[model samples]
Target: MHQCAKEEKVRVIACGAIAREIIAICKANRLGHIDLQCLPAIWHAYPEKITPGVENAIAEARAEGIERIFVGYADCGTGGLLDALCAREGVQRIEGPHCYSFFAGNAAFAENDDDVTSFFLTDFLARQFAAFVIEPLGLDRHPQLKPMYFGNYRKLVYLSQLEDENLKRKAKEAADYLGLEYEYRFTGYGDLTSALTRL
Candidate 1:
């Protein structure tokens, strides 16, 4: 994807925990090297704030003449960080609404389908739900079994998961907060499955 982006004259710089993975994928496809770096701890914790270490990552990439940067990890994990870094460095950052969803369009991902649920089979998607869905819903709705609607269902993926004891607590809290419909299903990665299944 980066290569395609670059071939189209898109300047590309990559940062994230999976920087190595991006590097491997790019190299395997003979994508030319730009600049790559593992995310710093500060970037992960308080993404809005870039410490000296985080600055170093940007500097290293810049030194390689990378004109633009794209943080390659899931949005939940790196979105905040990307936002902060872009603000702090005055450098542009490109990320998707969600990381898994972003890859669906990238040629680097070789799936026949752009189904979001397919990511649930990956630990990557599991982590994304834990942050984006589980956490926010917990703070808001308290995690009750409920139906969720997006943009009037223009494109939606629906799947259900049985709540674990812990998920039950969060679900109850989410129910009170978000007030969306929820149902008991047999899987844990509901958010990804739902959106992807619909696609």
Candidate 2:
């Protein structure tokens, strides 16, 4: 088992997608006792890279003498590998299948079975839709591929972490581009706040 650090402060190794929200939460709560580190947001599309990346970050932090570390990722499509790594390393992570569940509050998200046909986008994703979703999915290169990719998705749900009208507009446009209905949910960091407070 890993030992706790003598220092009272803790480090949070986060997914780059939620880095801004994590920082905002820390600043708003005056959680100077915690530090934050993040891997690339693009890794959201590449689940295979997440485990090693998080492991490397943890090792780096431990080498810096920070024995207390909290992973900011949920299972995040790692097929429980991320959880397994955390278990072996003796570090705790936010509880949920992914960021969407955590941001919407795990219990509420679990109860919302109507969202199974939904495609989700957070603020960061809304901003990077073109780069991350459109281009990467080849929708920009081949418009005919849109239906193939989004055929099963009936709606695009924009889970807003902050009240940004521009991002909402962008999310709506993304839904339009994907030929899906649009929805907006203002979650405001939901359980992320509580998780950080626990640190």
lDDT of 1 by residue, 111-174 (tens): 4353432222122222244465545445345433323432222222222233245545454443
Q: Write the per-residue lDDT of candidate 2 for residues 43-119, one digit (tens) a residue.
A: 99999999999999999999999899999999999999999999999999999999999999999999998899999
Question: Which runs in model 2 stand beyond 4 Å of their true positions?
Answer: 1-7
- The window of 10 residues in a row where model 2 has the poorest summed lDDT is 1-10
Report the number of clashing residue pairs per model. Answer: 26, 0
- How close is every model to the real structure, measured as TM-score? 0.36, 0.95
Q: Considering only N, C-alpha and C atoms within 3 Å, which residue pairs clash in candidate 2? A: none
Worst 10 residues of 1 by lDDT: 151-160
Error of 2 at 91 (Å): 0.4
Cα lDDT, all candidates: 0.40, 0.90
**Can you give the lDDT of residue 115 in candidate 2?**
95
Top candidate by lDDT: 2
Model 1 TM-score, 2 decimals = 0.36
Positional deviation of residue 84's Cα in model 2 after best superposition, in angstroms: 0.6
